[model samples]
Target: MIDQILEEIRRYETIIIHRHVRPDPDALGSQGGLASLIRDNFPGKRVYIVGEETEDLRFLVRMDEIADSAYAGALVIVCDTANQERVSDSRYSCGARIIKIDHHPLVDSYGEPQWVETSASSTSEMITSIYRNHPELVLTGQAARLLFAGIVGDTGRFQFSNVTEETFLSAAELMKKPFDRQKFFDTLYQRKLAVVRLNGYVLQHFTLTDEGVGFIKLPLDLIHSFHLQSSDASTLVNCFSTTEGLKAWVLFSEEEGLIRARIRSKGPEINQLAARYHGGGHPLASGATVYSWDEADGLIADLKVLCSRT
Candidate 1:
């Protein structure tokens, strides 16, 4: 499938990389690695990346250089994205031809050639597979670092249950490169003192519905009180959901005059509940936007029904 994807890549003179909205390390990493791969192998071709703004993910390098004009006659390779609606750029639909390389299941197939690997740990792992079979292709340091970071971040330093033998092999390949492992971990784990304290504040407000659904709410005012960035407020939605015994967790924070929610589940398809309020994502993790805290509370009540059903 990768070789076929590569064959398709060589057909286009211009390429644009894309990923899901509110980009994570995996999404940005795959975009970076793939762009580097193409630019290295096809020197005459033009490659660009597109998606939502994730300044933190710029650690991967060159991910910030994409221009929207690249959409013309471009083969857009979308990474780490599941649902089409959740993709960062609607302009992707306007691409001459689209190719999707993702580790998430298909919600819809917009591309002529789509690669979705449900069992893969991350999209970066798939990109590693691409480079593995063809090592003749140059592995730029920027690309290598992006792939490494995605593998580590999505695997939670290989601590998550999703870490498979394949994940280890992909990681082992990356470790062969000369990179500072300690500094990488520090970059990911280290948080501002205020950001660290805010986690404590969110944890303090946590409540579990009778059905074993855990939730934390951070009002917009509270976000203001802490002088937290919207990204910081948005980042805490999944921390509690990933706990050992919890069936589900919800993080509700206000941003730009709307309540943005991040929901996660261990044993249930909480996305159905998220869809009820005009938002969606993977079954285990999803999001919704609501007008007020009251609406968010109603969504929470609906989510409890899902938890109870599970």
Candidate 2:
């Protein structure tokens, strides 16, 4: 797979990298890392990283805006995205050849050459694997650092169950490059007082059902009170994890006319439940969006039942 991907890179003179919408660290990292890798090794190739930025991840890398004509003969490399609808740019389809590199479960196979490694901790890890196998492709310090950030971010600092021995090996390889690991952590975790207070509110108002399903529902007013976007508050679902006597937890924040949910579980396949609510992701970490509070409650009820069964 690495050989084939490398061959595709050699064939294209112009390369455009993309990831999922509302880019996460893994998404941005893999996109940026691959772009850097390609540029470092193949200096003649024109590389561009295109994506919609997230406030939390803007510090990592800058996104590029290219003319639509640039994609006419370009090679598009998409990372960390499961489905085409979630792709950040619609121009990806304009490329002469499309390469889909992802760690998500196969949702839709949009690219001619698709590499999906669901067992990999993150898409960044998979990219690191490619670098490991193909030493001919120069891996710069900046690219390694970006890949390291992606691996750490997706694995929850190696706390998530997805972290395998290969994850650590890949991380160790990236760490070989001289970068400030402490500084990266500091930037990744830096939060404002408002976010701290918001977390306190979430913990204080969190609900626990009889079936051990912990949940917090943040209404539009509460979200506005914190001066936070729904996606910002949804990230607080991590606070519900590691608590005693809780099988699964979800954070629901009002987004526009819908309620966006971020779901986490100590154990159990909750992505199936999220699928019913118009969203799906990894087994333990998944998301959903519902039209009404009643629908959110119904989804919560289903989760409670799932917990009881487990």
Candidate 3:
């Protein structure tokens, strides 16, 4: 798969990289990491990473502003995205060809030579394998930093069950580069005062069901009261994850007329449940959307049932 993707890379002079919307570390990491690999090894190739920017994660990497004409004969490669609808840039289809490199379970297949490795920990790890297989490819410090950040973010600092021998091996390999690990950790975890206060509110208000199902609903008004955006609430999903008897958890943060559900589990397969509600992801982690508060309650009820059975 790496050789096939490398072949495509070699074929295209103009390459654009993309990832999922509501960009996370792995999304930007793999997108930027792969771009760096291509740029360094194939210096003449025009590589660009495009996506809507997030304030908190801008330090890791930034997006490029390319004209539509750039995609006239470009090769678009999407990383860390499971579904086509969730892809960040609509212009991905403007390219002549599309490739998918992701670690999530297949949700909607679109690209040719789709490389979806559900067991690969994170897409950044998969990107690292490219350099491992082909030593001639230059692994720059910037690429190593981006890929390391992605792996750490997706694996919860190597604490999540997703981490495996290959994950550590990839990290070890990337560590051979010269990026500052301490500075990266410090910058990646830096939070604002508003987010810190909201964390207190969540700790005080989140509910845990007797069936080991934990959930928290953050209304738009409540999030606004904290002077934060709906996306900011996503960082708090795992805040109460360590609660005793917790089998599964859901964090619902309201947006304009709809609520986004970030679901996590230790026992139940929640991606199928997420798919039923307009979302899909890994077995232990997933996301969905609800149109109303009542619908949000319905999701909680379903999660409780799932936990009870587990």
Candidate 2, 1-310: lDDT as tens digits: 9889989999999999999988878999899999988899899999999978888888889999889999989999999998898899888899998899999888788897899999999999999998899766688888998999999989999989999999999999999887888888999888877888899998888998888899999998998898877888856889967778899999999988889899999887898899899998999999889999999899999998899998
TM-scores of all models? 0.90, 0.98, 0.99
* Stretches of candidate 2 exceeding 4 Å from the true structure: none
Lowest lDDT 10-residue stretch of candidate 3: 131-140
lDDT winner: 3
Can you rank all candidates by lDDT, best first?
A: 3, 2, 1
Q: Which pairs in model 2 have colliding backbones?
A: none
Q: Tally clashing residue pairs in candidate 2.
A: 0
Taken over the whole model, the C-alpha lDDT of each candidate is 0.79, 0.90, 0.94
Candidate 2, residue 37: lDDT: 88
Report how far off residue 292 is in candidate 1 (Å): 2.7
